[model samples]
Target: MLSPSPNSSKKAFSRVALVGKFHADGIEDHLKDLATLVSGLGCEVFIEAETATHLGLSGYPTKTAQDFAGSIDLVVVLGGDGTMLGIARQLAGSNVPLVGINMGRLGYMTDIPFQSVKDTLPKIIAGDFEADTRTLLDAVVLRDGKEINRALALNDVVVNRSGISGMVELAVQVNGSFMYNQRSDGLIVSTPTGSTAYALSAGGPILHPHVAGILLVPIAPHSLSNRPIVLPKHSVTVIEVVNGLEVIVNFDMQSQTNLQSGDKIEVRQSDKTIALLHPSNHSDYKTLREKLHWNEYPSTF
Candidate 1:
């Protein structure tokens, strides 16, 4: 068990919104339990509109994502990292911090486990947590020099080929300077906070959250020499589709749009950021070791 900070006895967030993964089973019970506990702490609780609707929950106040922005002090998210990502992006620029209770696999950003929620949530609500501010990426899709679509991502922006399509030919540029032409399955532009996600699996290096950098990872390039590279946080990366069939650009894999052969994606760090609250005992290395099984030895001798 982790010990709380010395300030645990002091109240931190007086108003909190509970956001949960609507698709998960038995989520109502969890929300109810959380509401009971939170209200007992003398704090006002609001349920995210959709989650409340899905569970048909009554008695608790409900607020939409937009409504939560300036009204709430903190957001308590329950689910996997995907759920956290969605809410974080929705609530970006609000300056309201978020804490996650993990109910999914990998549980990277969703640090608190369900078994530990009771212990952790109270401590966090009482000002016993560490705060981390993470960067977001703003991406715009252009066709014929006209902006066709745009989105924001807390994890990564991926441009990839659709099913049965051949390798995508992409022309890359950094801050208006030509970089390379690559034939590959796809490309990933990840922020430091997302270094351990798709970028890591694509052979990109893990950048600590404090690093002010962006990562460009090639997804199985035709030429093995095309490796991942780190770019300055201010560098604007433009990826033009030289050729491909049914190419698609995804924003954190939550939203996507089809890309034309001449389409270009412009990606850059956004002015908005999301804050994550963790227990005082949280450690990035500890999370990596536990989540990636680094501390476990191989069973086969």
Candidate 2:
């Protein structure tokens, strides 16, 4: 029911990668709807090859997220923000602009509403879009100076106690300066983009995405006096297990790795970044108000 932007050009690009998690209820139908819309726009729609079998889609060449990312100019992700994260990880270093259509809850990453795609898609194809270049964090676990596990997150990285009881002592440092040694449930080191996520849930404040800073929030400190602190972008937060107890480290609420006592964990902004495609002039406050219902006052009309 919406029209393309006035300046849309038909010769922009002819190929697209439609990525989504079709297993969720009602998602398969949404994928079909998206494909139809893309087709109507005159672009050749290629479902991520591997996703074909799961979605039971036919007549289109199926490809893995990796393979499809290599051949497409744009990637349209369906479902929620988490689904987009899964797909975007595959497109890292590929420089393919990603558009996320929110079909899930708390879709901070996938901020676009499903119904708005009618107008949104056209604007994107015409290159009438904005890009948010988000820095990714890379965490590498070392076992006696040898690389064990390495991963990236658009959100935060957490290191916490394994069992429900008892507190773990964490030695915190920033750029080689010692901060504190505290006993708490865990610790969260989040980027500005992740400030509103789990970090907020653990009593951290919301930071505008443009802020070149990181948040170091302690989760339920045993002393009750410890509070969250913001550090500069050029800083590095190094965590060490001072008490020689085993603990778990979670990356972006997805994957995890366990670091034994005496192991050192270093976290820093990655040289790599994820580029998100926005529709231009989009304000961070606007999204916060809309998504969080900031104006939903109790007694307002």
Best-performing candidate as measured by TM-score: 1
User: What is the per-residue lDDT of model 1 for residues 183-294, given as tens digits with 9 covering 90 to 100?
Assistant: 9999999999888999999999999998999999999999999999999999999999999999999999899999989899999999999999999999888789898888
Q: Which is the leading candidate under lDDT?
A: 1
**Per-prediction TM-score:** 0.94, 0.89
Per-residue lDDT tens digits of candidate 2, residues 105-217? 64777888888887788777767778888877777776677777888877888999877647888898889999999899899999888898889889999988878888889
Report, for all candidates in order, the number of backbone clashes: 0, 3
TM-score, cand. 2: 0.89
lDDT of 2 at 106: 43
Candidate 2 C-alpha RMSD relative to the actual structure: 3.1
Model 2: worst 10 consecutive residues (lDDT sum): 1-10
**Poorest stretch of ten by lDDT in candidate 1:** 1-10
